[model samples]
Target: GGRTPRIFKIMIKRVVVINMEEINRFLNGRGSISSNILTGIMVLNILIHNKPSKEHIKVGRVFYTNQGSRSLSGGVEAWQGYFQSIRPTPRKLMINVDLHATAFYESDSLVQLVVKILNKRSVDDLRRIHDRDRTKLEKCLKNLKIFVTHRGE
Candidate 1:
């Protein structure tokens, strides 16, 4: 099992040091948004959208979930998720959300996953994977995030 994560609370005093004239100009569409303001808004979006959730797995701006998972191919499954962001318009700010989908490896032993991916009946029948199959497996597992529990996380 994985260990529980610790949460820390921090208190920050906000000090408004932005130029009102520039902000007004940007809001009125007379000028472009400043880098500092954009950066601050992006950071705020990250903090707000990343609230802890036991039902979803967040990866950057996308939230992947098993709620509507569907078997795609072999050991891979398609997961439905969403991407959320805060966008500022000339008149007001809006929260933009959209649906997203991606493939995820099944949560199981690597050997089992390999068996499924290769369409094998059992691990005992496998001696070694062919070079072509190895390449295919590498492509499928590339950049896949994994959680290790053998060492107790």
Candidate 2:
């Protein structure tokens, strides 16, 4: 057994057929639409609009990058991002875009991040970090994605 085929089975229990005219009328508030159809359309819109990008990190509807980073207290950096969504209106779909601000850890070593967060002069200051501060540091560093740079030795 070298490799196993990864396949999933999903079954749609019911199908409702509605004409474009009916959908248009419903969208215009002339008629009622099913919740399932509305949910499917919303999910489809999200998938089409949120395809992954190499340069941007997407979390839910917000997209951000390392560019234009502003340093904040405790080694946290504020990044400017944007939230985008497509909504169906009376006769057309409207794209809504809004500015968003998010906080990220500054690019630095673990020791440096700890030092900044604890307001310490150097690693030596961490030798006697209080339990409360240690818990704070744990929460801050938890689930943080770190990249290692290797230099030829």
Candidate 3:
């Protein structure tokens, strides 16, 4: 008898944020404080992956994909390229904002938290739980100080 291939389901969650302040800072040649923070989150994800192998974990891909017209276009293009490279057959995308992080700390803080979560898990294991119940997740995340806007399903 032939053995069945052990198929693995990976769910990759990604968050993208666009902050005006960060864009202004970058354009003015000033240190992009917000951008730096966002970068930190991306780095954190990589760090999370370092410990566990990719086969056993799920990851959330988060970043700021829109800032302004030009910036947003660039970000979207880059992300589209990246998504295609990954080749997610039925990609599920969600948008969320950390009320506290973005409102108080900075947009980057929220981005960082997302990256941290993504890095620890494998794409297959990363399930999009938000789709099941947007309002419920919204309420849960809101209470936890994270606010999200669902853009795409």
After the best TM-score superposition of candidate 1, give how far the Cα of residue 110 lies from its true spot, in angstroms. Answer: 1.3
> For residues 1-153, what per-residue lDDT tens digits would candidate 2 score against the true structure?
688988999998756543556556767888777765476567656665655344588776778878888999999999888777666778766677788889988889778988999889999999998999989988988999987777662
Q: What alpha-carbon RMSD in Å does predicted model 1 have with respect to the real structure? A: 5.4
Estimated TM-score per prediction? 0.62, 0.63, 0.19
lDDT of 3 at 52: 34
lDDT of 1 by residue, 114-141 (tens): 8888888899856876888888878877
lDDT of model 1 at position 150: 77
Q: In candidate 1, which residue ranges exceed 4 Å CA deviation?
A: 1-40, 52-55, 138-153
State which candidate, 2 or 3, has the greater lDDT. Answer: 2
lDDT of each: 0.76, 0.78, 0.36
| lDDT ranking, high to low | 2, 1, 3
Candidate 3 — worst ten consecutive residues by lDDT sum?
79-88
Lowest-scoring 10 consecutive residues by lDDT in candidate 1?
Answer: 15-24
Indicate the TM-score of model 2.
0.63
Mind giving the per-residue lDDT tens digits that candidate 3 earns over 49-72? 453343321223322222221312
- In candidate 2, list every pair of residues with a backbone clash: none
